[model samples]
Target chain A: MNFSSPLTPTPVAIVVGASSGIGEAVARKLAHEGYAVALVARRADRLRALCAELNARPGAAHAVAYPHDVTHFDEIPALFQTILRDLGRLNVMVYASGIMLPSGFSEYNFGKDRATLEVNVLGAMAWLGQAATYFEQAGEGHLVGISSVAGDRGRVSNPAYHTSKAALSTYLESLRNRLTRKGVHVLTVKPGYVDTDLLKAVARPFWVVSPEQAAADIWRAMRRGKQQIYTLSRWGLVMWVVRHMPSFIFRRLRF
Target chain B: MASFPSADRLALLTNFGHSIGSVAYVYRPTHAEQIAELYRSAAGTGFTVGMRGAGRSYGDASLNGGHVALDLQRMNRILDWNPGTGVIRVEPGVTIGQLWAYTLEDGWWPPVVPGTMFPTLGGCLAMNIHGKNNYVAGPIGEHVAQFTALLPTGEEVACSPTQNADLFHSLIGGLGVLGVFTSITLQLKHIYSGNLKGYAWASPNLRQMMDEMESLKADSDYLVGWVDGTWGGSGLGRGQVHRAHYFAPGEDPSPAQSLRVEAQVLPDTFFGLVPKSILWQFMRFFMNTPGAWLTNTAKYVHARTLDHRHHFLQSLVAFNFLLDYVPNWEKSYGRGGLIQYQSFIPRAAAAEAFADLLKLTQRRGLPTYLGVLKRHRPDKFLLSHAVDGFSLAMDFKVTGGNRPALQRLTDDMSRIVLDAGGRFYFAKDSTLTREVVAESLGPDTLARFCAMKARCDPQSLLQTELYRRVFGSI
Candidate 1:
C-alpha cells in the first residue's frame, strides 16, 4: 500500500487495442504479473468490462481503462502523459491495435486498403513513437509491436494488410537497433492465423491458435529479450521457406 | 493574449543544482485567475499540475515529468508593506533577494533565509526552509502571518495560525501539492543595522564541534559549522564553527549607512582583481578525488593556524548567502551534477550516527566535497524534518562511472539515518523510498496528511515527480 519507493514502484504497462484479442489477453497477463495495466482502445464498453475483470483480482496492481481512437494523432501526447500520471511509471508498452478488412480476391479497393494502413501502421507509429522517446530517456523499457507472418512474402490475398505488417516489422527492427544500446528492448511478434475477430472471415484457418496462446508466446519472447519472434514456433520455419521461394514461382502460386 | 489553456509549451526544467531534470508542458501564469482557469481546464483531463516557483528545488520536488508545470515566477508583485510593523505582503514569485533589497533600508530582514537569495518565497514556504538561526527562529513558516491559496478543486481559501490551522500547518510543508499559494503575508525581523559581530573557531573533531555549538546556541544569533569530510583518524569530523550576533542599538556608529542596499551587495570580484564569475572554471581543476583531498587538507590547516579564534565584523549578506558567492560553482561538479544527502537526527544519537555516515563515505572513497552542520529544534508542521538535535548536509560529486557506487553509499546512509530516527527534507533529496517515509512519518501523521489531500484535491489533480516518487498516485 505504501508507494513511496522510487526504486521499486509497481511496474506499469500500456496495452493499446486492449478491448479484445491479444491486447486484452496481454493486459490481463501483465496485471496478473503485478503490473498496473492501462487498457487503451476505442471500445469504452469493452474496456470498462475488461478493467472490471482485471481489477477484481486480489493484488496491489490493477487495470484502468483509457478509451481512445489511435487515429487521433493530436491527442496521443497528452494521453501519454495522463496515463503516466495515473500509473506512476511506465515499464512496458504493447502496440496491439490492428484491423483486417475483407477484400475481393480479383478486385482492388483503395478505401479498404487505406483504412487498413491507417489503423495498422500509422496508429502504431504514433503510440509507439511516444513510448520510444520516454524509454530512451529513462534508459530502460520494453516495446512490443504485433506483426504477422502474412508479411513474409507478397501474398495473393490482402495486399494492404500484408504491406502494413511488413512496415510494422521493419519499424520495430529499426527501433530495436536504435535503442539496444540505450537499455530499451523492442520486440516484433509475428503470429500466424490467430483465432480472433480479425480472422472471422477465414474458414478452416491453418494452424489457428487461441488469442491467449498467442499472447503467452509473445509474453515469453518479451521476457527472453528477443528482437523478433513467431508464435507457435513452427511458423518461423514456414515463414523462412515462404520468404526464400523463387519470385517467379511464388507469383504463380495460390493459397 | 495567450489564454491559460493555450499557454502551455514543451519545456525541460531542471533543479537548481542541475542534478535532476524532467520534460513537461510548462505554463507561466501572471495572475491568480489564470491558475484557477488552468485548474478548470485540467479537471478530469487526466493530467496533473505541479506548481513551480523559480525552479529552485535541488531535486524532483518542482518537476512534473510528462505533465503540466505551473510556473509562478511571473506573478511577482509586492502587494503591501508596513515599514513600522515590519509586515509585508507579496505574491508567491518574489525572491529572497528582492524582499531583503526592498526592506533592508527600513531596517527589516526576512525572518529566515537559506544560503542562496534566488529562491522564491513560494518555494521557501513550500519547503519550510531553515537557516543558521533555525534553532532559535524555527523555520520560515513560523514567521508567516497569513496566506491565500487556490486549491485544485476550484476553491480559494485564506489560512493562518488561528484560522484554518490544520491547513496552515500542512500547506506550508506540503511541497505545493495541496494548493498553490496566491499571496503570502510575512512578518520580518526588525534590525538596527546590516552588520553582525562574527566569530570563527576550529574544532578538533565531531564531538567537540557539537559541544561548541551547544555551548554557543544561547548567546549566538546564528551558528554554522564547516566540516572537513576527507579527514580521518583522531581528526575525523574536524571543522570550523562560524557564529554571528546582531549589533545592538547604538553599538553600530553608522547604522543608517550600513542598512543601505549598497552596503550589503556582494562583491563581484575577488580582492578587487579576479572576477568571481570565472572562479568555478578554476575550481573545476580541483574537483577530482586527489585534488579535493589536497584542497580540503590545505583548507583545514589554514583554518587551524590562521583563522583559529578569528574575530571580525561581517555584513549580513557576507555572513549568509555563501552559496551565491561563487556563481555556477555547482557546475564544477561536471556533467553528472551533484546530490546533497542531508539527514536530521535526534540529539541523543547525532554524534554516533553522523560519525558512521562520515566514515561510510570515507570507507567507500567518496568523501563529501562539502559538509555543513546545523542545529535544529522540532516544529509543528505535519511533514517537518526538523529534530531537536543536528543536521549534516554532505555534498557528493557525481560522475557517470561512480553513480552506481554512489547509489549504494546513499542506500547505506539512509539505513543508518532511519535506524537513528532521522527524517529527510524533500527539497534536498534525490533518493528516498516509500517505506522510509512511512516509517519516519508514522501511520497517524501520514493518514492525516492524506486525508487533507483528499479533501482539498478530490480528483488528485495536483502532482509532481517528487510526489509520485515518494507517495505514488494514491
Candidate 2:
C-alpha cells in the first residue's frame, strides 16, 4: 500500500475527444491512476457527465471539463495555456479527436471528406503542435496521437478517412524523430477496429476490440515509451501482411 | 518524464489585500521532514518553491506563479510556552491571533504586532512587520530570540543575534527566499492588564501631525494616525491620532478579568446590532471616488467636532487589529481589488515628500481612499525598509480603466520617494520595478543578499514572483 502524502502533486494529463470512445476510456484510466485529468471535446454535455462520474469516485484525482471543438484551430493556443494555468503543469497530452463518416462505394461528397479531414488530420496538428512546442521547451513530456491501421493502405471502402490516418501517422512519426533527442516522447497509436461510435457502420467487424481494451493498450505503450503500437498486438502481423501486398492485387479486394 | 508524485492540487492564491494573484501548485507540509523531501524532489526539476504563511501580504510577496507554493499554515503548533518568563517557542504557522489568545490570560502579549492579528509569526518576521509602537520597540525581528530553519540545500541550522548573525538578520527580512523557518522562539511583552489608556486628537495638517507624533513618542507606547487623503490645500494630510499607554503595575482594579482570553476576542457584531460579516456589502456603495470623498469628509467632521481630545480606555485587540474589525472589508473595493503604496521617508523629508505625493494624486484625480501614518526607527535587518522617520501608507481602489494610470502614478511616486532617500516595503508593493529596488537597496546590499541566497539555496529553487519582479535573475 503506497499512501500519498499531503504534499504530493498528482501528474496532469489532457485528453482531447474525451466525450466518448478511446479518449473517454483513457481519461477514466488516467483518473484512476491518480492523474488530474482535463477532458476536452466538442460535446459539452457528454464531457460534463463524464467529468461528474470520474469525480464521484472516492480517492480519484480531480477531473475538469473543457468544451471545445478541435476544428477551431485558432482557439487551441489560448485554451492550451488556460489548461496549463488551471492544471499547474502538463505532463501528457493525448490527441484522439477524430471523425469517420459512412459513404456508399459510388458516392463521393467533398463536404463529407472535408469534414473528416478537418477533424482527423488538421485538428490533431493544431492541438498536438502546441504540446510539441511546450514539451520541446520543457525537455520532458508525453504526446500520443491515435492513428489507425486503416492508414496502412487505401482501401475501396473510404479514401479520405484512410488518407487522413496516413497523414496523422506520418506526422506523429516526424514529431517522434524530431523530439527524441530533446527527451520528449511522441507515440503513434494505430488501433485496430475498436467498438466505438465510429465503428457502428461496420457489419460483423473482425477482431473488434472494446474502447477500454484499446485504451489499456495505448496506456501501456505510452508507459513503455514505444514510438508506435498496434492495438491487441495481433494487428501488427495483419498490417505487415497488408503493407507488403502489391497494389495490382489489392485493387481486386472488396469490403 | 520527470514526475512529482507528492505534489498537491493547483490553487489560485491572492494576497490579503486582494490586489494581486497567481496560480501555482500549492503544498501543505505538516512536518520539517516533508519540506526536506520537497526540496530533494525539486532539486533538478524546473519548479521553484515559494514559502507562504497565512497569505497575509498585501501584494505578490507569497505568490510563485506557475511554480510550487509551500504553505506552512498546517504546521501550526505551540511547541513550548513559558508564561513565567514571557517567552514562547512555536512552529512558523502559529498566527498572532492564536499566540495572543493563548497568552493573554497569563498577562503576556506579542511585543511587535501589525495593524492586524491574523498574520502568522513567520510572515510577520519575513516582512519584519511593525506596529503603532515601532518608533519605540522597532519591528518584530527585534523581538525574535532565535529560530531554526531548513535551507533549500537540506541544511538544518539554528540562528540568533549572536550565532550566524548575518543569516539571522537576512532571513528575517529575506522574504522567504533563503530557507524555510521551522521553529521560531520569541520574547513576549509582559502586561498587567488587557486594557490600555487611549487618547485621541486631530491634527489640522501634515506638519502639525508630524510634530505631534514626534513630541508624543516619548510619553506614548503606541501612536497611529489616520489621514484624510480626500482633503487638499490648507487641509492637506489632515488626520486623527490615537495614542495608547499600558497600565501601571497597580493601575487596573480587575486585572484578572481584563487579562482573560475572552476579553481579547473582537466582538462579531457592530455595537451588538449589525453582523460585521455583512457590512462590506453596504460599504460597496461607498467605494467610488465621490462616495469615498463624502465618507472621509463626514468622518473627519465627526472626529473634529465630537471626538476631539477624547480620553478613554480600550482593549488591546480593539486598538491593535483595526483591520480585522470588519471581515472581508476589502470586498467593498469590488473585483478590481485594491493596492497599498507605503513609503518610509526620513523625518527631514517626510513632510515635504508626503505633501508632494498627496498633491500629485489630487492633481491626477486619483486620490487615495484611506491613508495610514506611522513613525519608525531604523533596524539592523539587511533588507530593512525602516528609517528614523515617518511612513505613510495609502490605499487606492483599482479598476480596469485606471490600471495603466495607477501604474504610472506609482512610478512617479517612486521617483519622489527615492529622491527623498525613502525606502519601499515589499509587503505592500505591487508596481515597483527592478531599477527602483536596485536604487533603494543600493548595489552592495543587493549583492550581499544575493550572495547569501546563492549560498543557502545553491540551485536557486526558493523564489517568488516578487523576487523575479524586483531582482530579475540576480
Candidate 3:
C-alpha cells in the first residue's frame, strides 16, 4: 500500500473511475510511486480532494485532477486530449471503475444488472479503447483493467456481475493482442474479495484483501509486464479449486 | 478492413520472430476445445498464430507481427499439484513467477528459473530456459514431467520422455515449431523460506576466474559469475563469483518467517525510466578507454565484500524480479531497443573461446553493461541450448547507428561458437544467422527438427518466425 514512498521520478498515470474502491486506491498508489497521476472519476469533488491530498504529500505535487465518467464515451476523447495538453504523454492507464449488483438468479433485477453491465463492461470498453488509441499513437503504454477472480467462472449467485467481468477480461485480452506489437502492454488485474465499497453491500469473507494490498498487487503486475495477473497470485490457486468444483458437489455447497 | 484481434498477434512472428512488429491480436483459450478451434481456423488461412506467455523474452522470439498472438496468460490454471510426488500440472500459460508465488508460500519452490521469472511454462519449455542452478537442476525441459502439445495438424498429443519421446524432445527446445503447448506437468522443489546461505568471491583475472568456477561447480548447488566484458588480455574474465547452497532441511533456516514479503525497492520507477538520451550518453562514456573495466572491477570488489546476514533475502523469484519495479525500464533503450547475446561454449574449450569472445567484444567496441558466466550441465533434450560448458550472457544496449557494428561482433562471436561446437541460446537471439544456428546446434539435430515439423505440420502450419530464421519457410 505504501509502495510509492521509496521510489522517485514518477511516471504519468491516468486512472479512470478514481472516485472510490480500487480505482481510488490505484490513483493513490500510482501517485505515491512518484507518478504524476491524472485522476479521472465521475465526481469532480472527490477527484479534487484526492488530488489535493496527493499534492499535500512530500513529493506529489505532480498529481492532477480530472473528473469524468468513463461511461460517457463521447467525453473520453476530450479527456485524453486534455491529458496530453496538460501532461504531454501518458505511460499508464488503469480502468478500476466498476459496479456490482447483488441478486439471486431467480430474482434478478434487469435495471440493476444493466447498470452493472454499463459500468463494468461498456465503460471499460470505451475507456480502454481510448487508452489503446493513445498507446497505439505513442507506440508504448500500459493499460491495466481491474477485474475480479469471479470473472474466472460465472457464479450462480451473481450472474450479471460475473458475465460483465468475464466479457471485460476477454476484451482486454483482445486489446492486448492488438496493442502488443505496438509496444503497448495490456494488463488484466484480477483480484479476489477485497475490502472495498463495492463489496460492502454484499456478503463478504473475513480474509478479504485490504484496498492498499490490492492496489499493490495491481501495481506489481503492471511492473512485471504480466498480461493477466491474479492479485495476491495465490488467489489463482483458490479460484482454480473453486472453478474446477464438480457441479453436483458445487451446487450442494452454500457460499 | 481486417480486425486484428489480440490473440492473433502470435502469427505475425511466425515468419520472422525478430522483425519489428506490434501486438495486434491476443486470444485466451481456457479450454482445449477453444485452442483446437483456433488452430483449425488458422490451418489453411495464411494467418500466423504465435503462442505468448509472460512477455519475459528479451528478444523478438515471442513476438508475431500482423498475426494473432495467442496469449495464454489466462490459461494459467493449476490442474493438479501433488505435494508428495512434487509433480504440478498446469496450463502452458502459467509463468515461473506464478509458480513461485503460489508454491513458495506453501514451502515449495521451482527448481529452475531463468534470470527473469516472467516466462510462461510453455515459453520455458519452448525456449528451454535455464537458470543459475542449471548445473544442479538442469534446464526447464528436464523438470517437465510431460506436456500436451497442440500440433498444426490440430492434434492434442501428450508427449513425454517415455511417451512420444521424439515429439517431446523436439517440442521443448523447438521454439514453438512443433505446435502450441497447452499444458505442462513439472517437478517442483521444496523450500523453507526466501533466504539462502550464499557467498560471493572476487577473482582477479579470466583464467583464475574460470578455474575458480570449475572448482565451485564440483560442490556448489547454484553458481553464476559476473565477468568484465570490456577488459581483454590475460586479466579479462575477472569479477565476482557467487555460490549459494540451500540449508539442509531442519538445519539452519532463517529465523525470519514470512510467506509474503514486501516488494523490493528499486533505484527507479515507471514515471522516471532512465531516458534514452542518458543511456546512450552513458554508453558512449562506458565504451571509452578504462570505462567498463574500471567500473566493473570496482563493482565486483564492492559486491564481493557484502556482509551476509540472516540473508532473509528475497526468494529466487523476487531476487530476479527487476522488471517488477521499473515496468517500462526496457524502453529506456528507446524504440530500436537492445539485444542480449548469450552463447554456450564447451567447458573444455571455454577458456580459449571465451577469451576470443572477450577479445571480439573489445575489437568491436560493444558496450556490455552486464556479463553473466554460468557453468551448465549437458542437456538431454534434442533442441535444448544448455551444453556441458560455460555460458556467457551479456546485454548490449544498441545505438541505432552502431547496430551494424554490433551485428558484426555477434557474427564473429557466432563463428567462434560454431568452431568450438558451442550453441547460442535462441531465446535471446536477434542477430544469429541460420547457418550459425545449424552449425552450432548440429545438422542432424536441425534435420530431426525439420523431420518432426514435416511429419506433424507438413504444410508448415506449426511455425514461428524463429523457425523461419534458421530453417527458412517450410
- Output the lDDT of residue B46, model 3: 58
Clashing pairs in 1: A4-B434, A5-B434
Error of 1 at A128 (Å): 4.7
Question: Per-residue lDDT for A1-255 in model 2, tens only?
Answer: 122211123578999999999999999988988899999999999999999999999878789999999989878876876677556567799999988898789879999999999999999998888778767755668999999998889998988899999999999999999999988999999988899999986766888899999989988998999999999789999899999999889999985
Residue pair clashes in candidate 2? A7-B6, A8-B6, A8-B7, A8-B8, A9-B6, A9-B7, A9-B8
Model 2 docking tier (incorrect/acceptable/medium/high): incorrect
Best by TM-score: 1
Better structure of 1 and 3 per lDDT: 1
Per-residue lDDT of candidate 3, residues B364-402 (tens digit): 777576688888988888887888888988777666476
State what share of the real interface contacts each candidate retains: 0.18, 0.08, 0.00
Question: Where in model 3 is the C-alpha error above 4 Å?
Answer: A1-255, B1-24, B253-295, B304-314, B318-329
- Residues A28-127 of candidate 1 have per-residue lDDT tens digits of 8888888889999999999999999988876547789999999887788768877876665678999999999876789699988988888899999999
Interface RMSD of each: 4.1, 12.4, 15.0
Error of 3 at B167 (Å): 1.7
Model 2 C-alpha lDDT per residue in residues B1-474, reported as the tens digit of each score:
334522234566888766666657788999999999899887876678899998888878998756788999998999999999989999999999999999999999999899888888888888889999999999999999999999998999899999999999999998999999999999999999999898887788888999999999999999999998989989999988989999989899999999998887789998899999999999999998899899988888877887746568889999999999889988899977888999999999999999999999889888999999999999999999999999999999987578767878888999999999999999988878888999999999899999999899988889887887788655
Tell me the tens digit of each residue's lDDT in model 3 across A1-255: 111110111357888888788889998898887788888888899889988898899846478888777667777755665564355346798999888866865867889888888889998888888778767855778999998887888777788888998999999999988999998999998887788877775775656788889898888888889898886789889888988988888777756
Candidate 1, residue B191: the lDDT equals 92
Provide chain B TM-scores across all predictions.
0.98, 0.98, 0.87
